[model samples]
Target: MTDDLDTPVLDNHLHLDPRHGRGVDAVKDFVRLGGTHLLVVNKPSWHLGVEPDEPTDFRPVFEETLDAVAAANEVLPGRAWPVLGVHPGLISRLVDDRGFSPEDARDLMQGGIEVASEFVADGDALALKSGRPHYDVSDAVWAASNAVTRRAFELGAALDCAVQLHTEASEDLTDLAAAAEEVGLDPTRVVKHYAEGRLAGLTPSVMSEKDRLERAAESGEPFLMETDYVDDPEKPGMVLGPKTVPRRVRWLLEAGYDDAVRRAHVETPRAVYEIDTESTLNRDT
Candidate 1:
């Protein structure tokens, strides 16, 4: 299984949140998981106005970083790909980028993000001391969200590009279709991101995945695959912990699921992110 990991992989949900502090080397860490490609969620750029007043720098929104990430991936053969798109949800200036380390991150945002583990290393000790992240969202935020949505589609169309967007964004597929239609594109040309898993109270993600496939069949529109890299206790978020990406990938194989989906998530996403224009199969079919 470890041997298979080096064979190449795909990762769907890559947040190069300015808050996340990513750099060129993120390619190596991703490659460890066979991450040859990534769907860089610039979804956070939708925030309109209500930004934090604290002079603290907000990491460049995901939209602004996609070009760099894509270039970074291209530097490494079969190593990097970036799915450029804006994130959903209003971006609040006060929002904490990292799950628990916002304060430590405040000072670091202007520079860049370190490793995911570096901030969470203290685990329980830090968890015990952690505080909540807050923000001020005014009418400007709602306004920004609306504005960014239009702006992103306009920009993507002009660039002749597609972008990564949350599955929830599908609620407005009509609006998306309008944009594509306005630009003389088949609605299928738009790429929706992170369509998976059934979260309680959230609509079934499976339906969206199936919808994506059906749409592709009809439109020949190329859609990318992605994962949020959820920290599942059902599948615990295992850190390097004496294991390498290949080793952990092997463990995931043992945990059990569809082999095709697993391989696509790890291998195919990497390829797509790195801009390899291969056909995406309907493994579920």
Candidate 2:
């Protein structure tokens, strides 16, 4: 694929896990395939099926992820950028031996407005997890996770980074007030990465595309549409694949929600939560 291909929408939720053996070459190939900016999001600790849930064979994927970004920068010059944060499902890793840090625990109790506002108020995007919308406890967690969620948010926001989440059916977030309250992260502080995408082995029903938009507007958060791909087709959507980006972009356009699609995966996200763009900028931790 070359840049001469379709008009590339901003690549919002492209996830590259070192565990998957993706290289900087793939990143350049994406840009060469017509992408303007490629936002490399956080992935599960390792490869699916072959790797354990958390990485036991290697160090945290974050470090390798940063290395890949460095390679991407070298390969594409100003294209590959980094987006850092913990996934809701992976929040377990962020917790100490006890659990989520006390601050995060408290934030989870309150609505996260004040707690999250304090952390990354200086950063880019406030990344948080809304779990699955259909789940009962997720609503409670959404109202709570905000405490420390924004610390990372501000860090990214200060750099104009976008918050991209890996959501599941049990992680439905169509209700703005309900979702924001449930996860405890400030909806206004970040853009959700995959509020409308389909999850594996789950029903296709969503919080109605129209209602999803209204929720985004009400929460003051930009919505993101992404292809959380897995390279092994045996895994399908587990990792962000090379073929999925444009295909999903076309899906959004055909739905006549191109503008919403663009903001979630492109414009707003790039302009806000991704300071890791361009290899030369190098902000990987």
Candidate 3:
């Protein structure tokens, strides 16, 4: 795939586990296939072999994620930035395996996001990742997870950065949008990661797929595209391939989606993450 596109091709949600996956090579695959920017989100604590008993325990998790981002940037400078925080699924582990109460688990997760906010505050990262568990769970656990998500929104507001949410597959974010508003964050700044496009009241970082892209493009509502590439060797190309975003961009362009492509890749990201992705890619090129 040629990298001759005029606008930047950005993958909004990606993970690079150097220990157990293609890691930087996966990122290289994206860059080689015309991807110009990546928001490298942190994998779960357990994925990196960390069992957090306290908030500071997440330090290693964030550090290693940042290391992976650094490694990616070393090879492809100005291409990757981090979105660090505890994965919401870890709450199940904390309450089930680690023997913590639901409330404690929720607080721990919030604390983890708070720790992550320090990196954003220091300007080491661009966004924060947090959300409730996508799978089924008890009511108490669900409540706790929602609380953690709200804490993430509050932190995002304080840092004046975006929050990338990994939640259930639902288009209605009415409640979450209200929570963000309640916390003094602009609801538009909250991105629903792994989103199905045309979300009710927030930015949808829709997964890169033909039909989904078509619908999102036709809707005329601003949205971003992502591969959500997990980069796991065992489950290689789990969610989507690393090159999916750039490849889809090409497909959309061929289908005469120039305005949609520009809106998704450049306008939405600049408005949400406050990054000049197109200009940044232009300068780097």
Q: Highest lDDT, which number?
A: 3
Ten contiguous residues minimizing lDDT sum, candidate 1: 124-133
Per-candidate clashes come to: 27, 49, 0
lDDT by residue for model 3 over 1-285, one digit each (tens)?
446567788899989998889988887788777777889999988988889988999998998888999888765533789999889999999999888999999988999999999999999989999998889999999999999999999999998999999999998988999999999999899999888867997899999989888989999998999988888888878899897898999999999999999999889999999998856774353
lDDT (C-alpha, whole model) for all candidates: 0.35, 0.43, 0.89
Error of 3 at 71 (Å): 1.7
What is the lDDT, from 0 to 100, of the residue 106 in candidate 2? 36
The digit string of per-residue lDDT tens for model 1 on 130-241 reads 0011233345443444444444444445444433334342333466557546655334434444443322211111222333433322332233344443222333232211
Better of 1 and 3 by lDDT: 3
For candidate 3, the TM-score is 0.96
TM-score of 2: 0.53
lDDT tens per residue, model 2, 99-212: 565445434322332222232343322332223222333444544444334343343344333344444343444453233434443444344454443322211112223444
TM-scores for every candidate against the unseen true structure: 0.45, 0.53, 0.96
